[model samples]
Target chain A: MDDPRPTSGPVPPRRPSGRLEESKGPLVEPSAGASASGPHEQPGLGHLLANCEGQELQPGLHAALEVCRPNTADLDDPALAEVQAALAADAGLRRRLASLQQFDQALVAALRDVRAPAGLEDRLLKAVSALAHSEGVEPLVEVEAALLAPSSDAASASCVPPASAEADHAACRDEAGYTSVRSGCLAPDTVLPSKRRAMRLSSRPMVLAASLVLVVGAGLVIWQYRRPASLPTPQQLANEATGQFQQDLSEGDGMPASKKWPAQVPASFPQLRLPQGTKWRTCRLVNVSAVMFDVTQAGVKGALYVVRAREVARGAQVPNTPSRVVFTQGVSRTMWRQGDYLCVLIVEGDEQALRRLLRPVPPVT
Target chain B: MVQDKPQDGIAELVARYHRELFAYAYRLTGRAADAEDLTQQTFLAACAAYHSLRDARCARGWLYAILRSQYLKQFSRARRLVINEDPTELEQIPEELPYEPDFDQELLQQALDRLPAEFKVVVLMFYFEGCSYKEIAEQLKLPPGTVMSRLARAKQRLRDALLHTGQPAFNGSMEAGVPQVVREGTPHVGG
Candidate 1:
C-alpha cells in the first residue's frame, strides 16, 4: 500500500514578494508557467497567482471570497462587489474560493458537533438564581423583620389594658370574642357560648404576656443564629494561598521582575525556614502586597502567604503561635503572626506534616 | 410570570446561549471545569447588570463580551507571567490527522489552541459566533485593520494546519486532485 500522507518537509522561505513559495513535494504544485521569481525580476503572473492561491488577497477580498454564492447583502459590500466581479471574470480564482469555502464549512461543521457538557443549562440557571437571590431588593434580615412585625403588634395590643375602665374592658373582650368566632378558632357546640366567652376574657391578658415573652425569645434566637460566620477561615486562607501558588506553577511563565518582592524586604516580614530536601521555587506579591512563597519538599508542594497587619482591616487578630486547622482529609493549615505580618502555611499531608513544617520557624526579632 | 421580570430574563438568556458561551469558553481555556466556571460567571455578571441593558437584541453579544472580560480578569495573573515569544516562527505540527469522514473536532481544536490568544479570540468571534469584523474590533477595542489582519493570519494558519495534519481528505481519499463539493447555501462571510 502506498503511504498516502503528505511527505514531511521544512516550510519554504518567503520570496522577496512576501509570499511563501511552494516547496518541491506533494504539499502544493505551481500550475503551468508558474515558477519562482529571480532576485532582480518582479514576480510574474504565475507567481502572483500562486501567491493568491492561499496567502495574500486584497484587504477585504479574503473575507469576500468566503461567500460561495454572493447574496444581495454580500453584493452590497463594495469590497465584496469588487472581489465577486473578479471571481466572475476568473475561473481559477473561483475554484480556489470554492475550495477555501469548503474547508471553512468542514471546520465549522466539525466544531458544531462538539456540544457543551450535559446539565450546563441547569447549572447556569442555578447560578443565575443564586446571583438574583444575592442581589434581591428585600434582604433576608429585612424580610424576617417585616414578617415578625404584625405578630409583635398583636402581642403588644393584648398586653395593654383598655384605658376607658370596666366598660371599655367589656367592649375589648366582645371584639376579641367576635374575632375568635369569625376566625373559626372558637367552634360552636363545643362549649356553652357564655362559658367560652368567660374563659377567653380571663385568659386574654396571660396569653398576651406569654406571647410577648415568646416573640422576644424567638427574635433573640434568630438573631443569634443568623449572624454572619467569620469569613476566610484559616483553612480557607490556606487554600487560597495554595491555589494561587499552584496556578502560578502550572502556567510555567517566568515571573516578571516587577511582580517579585522588593529587594530590601520590609523589616517586619517573617522569615520562613523550609524542611530539609525542600527548595524555594519562587515568591510573588499578590492581592495588593501580600507576599507568597512556593515551596516544594520531597515532591510535596506547599505555599506560605504573608500579609502586613496594617494592610488588613482594623482589629484583625493574628495568633502568636502556629495554630493548626484541618481543611479536609490529608490537608492542614498552620497560621501565626510574626512582627507585623500575618503568615499562613499550607501543607498537603496530615497535621503532623504541617506541624513539622511549622516547628522550625523562630519568633520575629 | 417569571419570564416577565427583568431579572428572570437572565435565565432565559442563559437557557438560550449557555452552550455557545460554554463552547467559546472551553475553546479559550481548553479546560472543561474552567469553561464551566467562566460560563457561570458570565451569566452571573449578566444577571447583576441585566437591569442596565436597554436593548434585548444586544444580549447575546453582551453576554459574550462579559465572558471575554471575565476570562481576562481570571487569567490576568497567568497571562502576565507569560514570556513573549517571537511570532514569526511556526511550530512543527503533526502531519497526519485521524482520517475520518466526520471531521475530528479534537484535531481542529488542537490547531485552534495553538494560535495566539489575540488571534484565537478574533477567529472564535468571527467564525463561530458570526461577529462582524467591526463588531469584533469594537468588542476587543482594536482597530478594524488590525482585526482584518489578525483574522487573515488566523485563517491562513488554520488552513496550513489542516493541510499539515492531513485533513480536508474526503471519503478516505488523500490524493491532491480529489475534488470536494461546496455545500449549498454557503454562509455569508461577515466583514
Candidate 2:
C-alpha cells in the first residue's frame, strides 16, 4: 500500500529552523539570512522542471540564474509538497535534515551554557563587597573576592541575585558564590531560595501542638518509662541547692571544716536556757552556707541564721547559758577573707574534736 | 545568621545547609534579596529550636524544613507573593535563559531571572544538580506529579522565551516565559 498519505501532519513547506522552533517549543524568529532564501528554491526544482516540461521556463532559467536569491514566500507555499516528498525520498536530504536538527540543538545548548560577562561579574562583586562590608565584612570577604574574579555576569547573574542596588544587602552571601558542605553544619536559612518561597502548612500550630503533645504525652511517656521527676519547685529545692553551693564553696577548695555535724542533720542539739540538770534534743545544725546558719536550738528548726566573715558583719549573736556549744574554727581557706565574706560546710562525726572545733562562746559578757 | 552553635542537630543542619540552601531560596521567592534574608533567618531559627531536629543526615531536609517555616513567618510580616490562580505551570518556573550578548552570560541569566518562582527553582535543581523528581518533590514537599508538570511547563516556557526575546526591559511572551506558557496540548517529545 502507498506509504499511507504523508502521516507527519502537513510536511509544512520548507522554512527556517528558527521559525519552526518559534511556532513550537520556542519563538525563534526568522534569522537575518531569511530574505536570502528567495523564490527559486521553492516550486522546488521539480516544479521548475514541470513548468519547463510544460514549456514555460526555458526562457526563464537564465532569468532565474540572473536572479540571485530565492523568494522566501514561494518556498513557504503548499505547492512545494511534491518537491518536499521528492527530497524526503533522497537519502542525502534525510541526512541533511538530521544534521541540521543536531546543529540546532547544539546551538540551543551552547546558548544555554553561555557564561555571564566579566563586567557583570565585576559589578556583582563590587556590589557584594559593599553589601558585605556594610554587614561588617569579616565573614563575607572571601565571597567578595570571588565576585571580582573573571566570571561572566550572565552565569553570575543567572545564578546570582539581581544587580539592583536595593539587593546589595541581600547579595552579600551570594557575593562569594556558593559552596557545598556536609548537611547540618551550615545555615540553610542563609541561602536565598530561587523559588517557591518555602511555603509551610502551619507555623506556630505545629510547634504548639508539638510542645503540647510533648508535655501531655510526656506524662504518658514517663508512665511508660517510669522516669524520675528530675526537677522540683524553687523553694523546696532552694535548701538542696544551697547545700550543694556550700560544698562547692568550702570543701571544694580542700579546706577542713570547723566542726562536724552528722551527714543527716543531727537528731537533737542542746537548747538555750534549759533547766539546771535537763538534757535536751540537740537541734539540727543544717549549714545554710556563706554566713547563713540552720541551727535548730529546740525553739529553732529548719534553715535560717546569718553568719559573717568580719566580726562586725556577723551582727548580733544570740545569748545562751554558761556551757554553750558554739561551732567555729578559723582554717586556712581563701574563701572567708576574700573581701569579708564567709562560707560554711556541713561535715560528718563528733565530740573529741569538738573542743578544738569550737571557739570560746564569745566570753560571757 | 546561621546558628554556628546550634541548639540541636536540626539547628546545626540549618547552618550546614546555609550556602547551598540559597539556590532553593532564590528559586522560591523569585528575588535573590528575599532568598538571602530568608536563608539567614532560617539558620537563626534552626539554632533557636535545635530540639526539633530529629535526624542529622536529613539536615538538608531539616534546613529546608526551617526555611518553609521562616518563609511563612515572613509572609505574615510582609506581602511577597500573591499568587491568585493556581499559577500555571509557567508561573511555577523561572524564565528560559536567552542568547548571550557578545558571549556575556548575563543575557541568558536575565532570561532565567524572568521566570516564575516555582518553575525557576525546579529548573535550577534539575539542570544544575540534576536532582530526581522525587528529590525535588521531597525538598519542596510538592507532589511528584506537580514537580513533573512544573518542570515540563518550565522547560517549554524557557524554550519559548529564549527563542522570542532576551532583554531586560521586554514584557510578556505567550506560552513563552513562565507567566504565559503556551499549552502545547500534548507533552513535548523530541521538540
Candidate 3:
C-alpha cells in the first residue's frame, strides 16, 4: 500500500551535517613505504578499512568513513574518491557495504510501514479538551460558547444570570488574543443539536418550577446558617450605657465643675448623684435622657451615665443592686436602678473600683 | 477586526499531523498504547506552548520536538539505557544474505527496541522524521559526529537482529532499562 504521507510535510530546513564540511578537506594519501601503523600517522584507506575487521573506528573517524558510503556520503567530499578507490580494490569491503545499504533500506521500510490506531485522533482530541478544562485553560471559543449558550426559556436560564454571562462573553470577546469564528453575538444555531434537542424537550414550566424550588430551598438553608443572634437584655442595657459613656469621652462637651445634676437632668432620676467634687455634663442618648459625670475616685478616671429605669429595655428587671456588671472593650460597667433612674459606672479598672465609687453614694443634699 | 487565535486551530492541527506523529512515537516506543499516550501528551503540551510556535509551516517539526522532549522526561529517569562503549564492534553483518529477506514490521520493531536510547532516538530522527545528522545533533545537543556514530551503531544492531545472524535475535537482555514490548517466551515486558 502507498504510504499515507509520502513527503516530509512542513519540515524545517535541514542543517548541513559537519561531516560534509570535514570531508571537504583534501584527502591525504599514505606513502607506499609507510607500513607502520602509529597513533600519530594517518592510516592508508586499506589500513583504515581493515581496522574495522575486529574493532570500531574512533567516533570522529567513523563518521568520516560512514559519510563516504552511498546512503549518507557527500558526493562533493574530497575523500569520496579515495574511499571509492579503496572499495573497488576490496571485494570483501564492497560486500559489507552492500549488506549495510540493504539493511538500512529494510529498517526504513519497516519503521514507516506501521500505522497509528484508527481511534487515536478522536481520543487525543477528547483527552486534550479534558486536560485544558482541568487546568482552567479555555477551549476553543466556539466550544466554550456552545457550552455556555442560554436556553430559550429565559426564566429557566435565570439561574445562570444571563447579565453576568453576557458581561463575561463581552469581556472574552474584547480580549486581544481570544478568537471567535462568528462576527457578532453568539447565534442559537451554534449550540449543539443534542443540546438544542434537550432544551426543546425539557423546557417545561414544571421543570423550571422544580428548579426554582430547589434554588429557594438552598437559599433558605444558607439563611438559616447565617441568622444574626440577639444579646441578653441585661447585657444589652450595659452595652448601651457603656456606648454613651465612650461617646461622651470622645465628643461630649468638657465636664463642668458642678457635681450636682443640671436642672435639665430628667426629674425621673432625681435620686441619681455622684461624689461631691466630680464634674458633670448632661446629654440625651436615643429616647433616654442621661447625665454624664466625669468622676475621679482614688486618682482613677471613670464615667457615669444616669438614665430612667424604664429606658433600660422592656421587661428587663431593673438592676436595683450593684451586682449586675458587664465588661466590654477594656471598660467594666456596673448598672443598678437608683430609685427611678438607672446608674451605670464605666471604669478601665476592676469591678471593685466601680463598687467603691457607688458604695457611699453620698445622698444628694 | 478580531483575528483567529492560533490555538483555535489546534483541533485542525491534530487532524493534519496525528498519524505521522503517532507513527514516529510508535517507532520510539514499540506499543500502540504508549504511542497513543505520547502523541496525546504532545498535543496537550502544544496547546500550552502554542504561542512559541512562530511559523505555522514548521508545526510538524515543533510537535515532533515536543513529543521527543516529553518522552525523554518520562523515560530518562525511569530507565537507564546501556550504551555499549564500543560503537564499531557493536554488530557484525554477514558478508551476504542467503536470499533477499522479507522484512517484518514486528521483527524490526523488536530490533529497534533493543537499541540504547541515544542511538534509537538518532535512528528515529534520521529515518522516521527525515531529519539530517546535523538536525538530530541540534535537537539532541550532541556533536554531529556523535549523532552519525549512534545512528551507525543503531543501524548495525538492527541489521544483525533482523538478519538473525547473531546469537538468538534479541536475548531480551535489557540492562537496566525497560523493554518496549513483551518479547517471545516472556510473559510480559519488564521494567
Taking the tens digit of each residue's C-alpha lDDT, what string does model 1 give over B1-191? Answer: 22446458987877667766766776676555666676776666666555545456556555666676666555433432221232321111112222122333344566666776667777776666555555455556567667766776676676566555554322222322334422233221111
lDDT, candidate 3, A1-365, per-residue tens: 11232222221111111111011112322223222432134222223223336543333444434433234434244534555555556544543444344344434544565444545566666655554454333333223222221222112111121123422232122222111111111111111222232232234344556889999999988765443222234456567767766665567555556766566444433333355666677665554567777865666657777766654454566666666666677677877676766777787667766666655545568
> After superposing candidate 3, which stretches have Cα over 4 Å from the reference?
A1-59, A63-98, A121-354, A357-365, B1-16, B44-57, B75-78, B90-99, B114-118, B145-149, B156-191
**Which runs of model 1 end up more than 4 angstroms from their true locations?**
A1-72, A79-85, A135-365, B1-6, B76-101, B166-191
What's the TM-score of each model vs. the native? 0.42, 0.28, 0.44
Per-residue lDDT over A296-347 for candidate 1, one digit per residue giving the tens place of the 0 to 100 score: 4555556667766544444445677776455554456677777766677766
Better of 1 and 3 by DockQ: 3
On the 0 to 100 scale, the lDDT of residue A356 in model 3 is 64
What is the DockQ score of candidate 2, to 2 decimals? 0.05
Weakest 10 consecutive residues, lDDT, candidate 1 chain A? A180-189
Tell me the interface RMSD of every candidate, in Å.
27.5, 20.0, 19.3
Residue range A149-215, candidate 2, lDDT tens digits: 1221112212222233322222232312133311211111222231222222113245556889999
Docking quality (DockQ) for each candidate:
0.09, 0.05, 0.14
For every candidate, C-alpha RMSD to the true structure in Å: 32.7, 22.1, 17.5
Model 2 residue runs over 4 Å out of place are A1-365, B1-5, B8-15, B30-32, B72-113, B124-130, B138-142, B166-191
Tell me the deviation in Å of residue B151 in model 2.
Answer: 1.4
Q: Is candidate 1 or candidate 3 better by TM-score?
A: 3
> Chain B TM per candidate, please?
0.71, 0.53, 0.77
User: Comparing candidate 2 with candidate 3, which one achieves the higher TM-score?
Assistant: 3
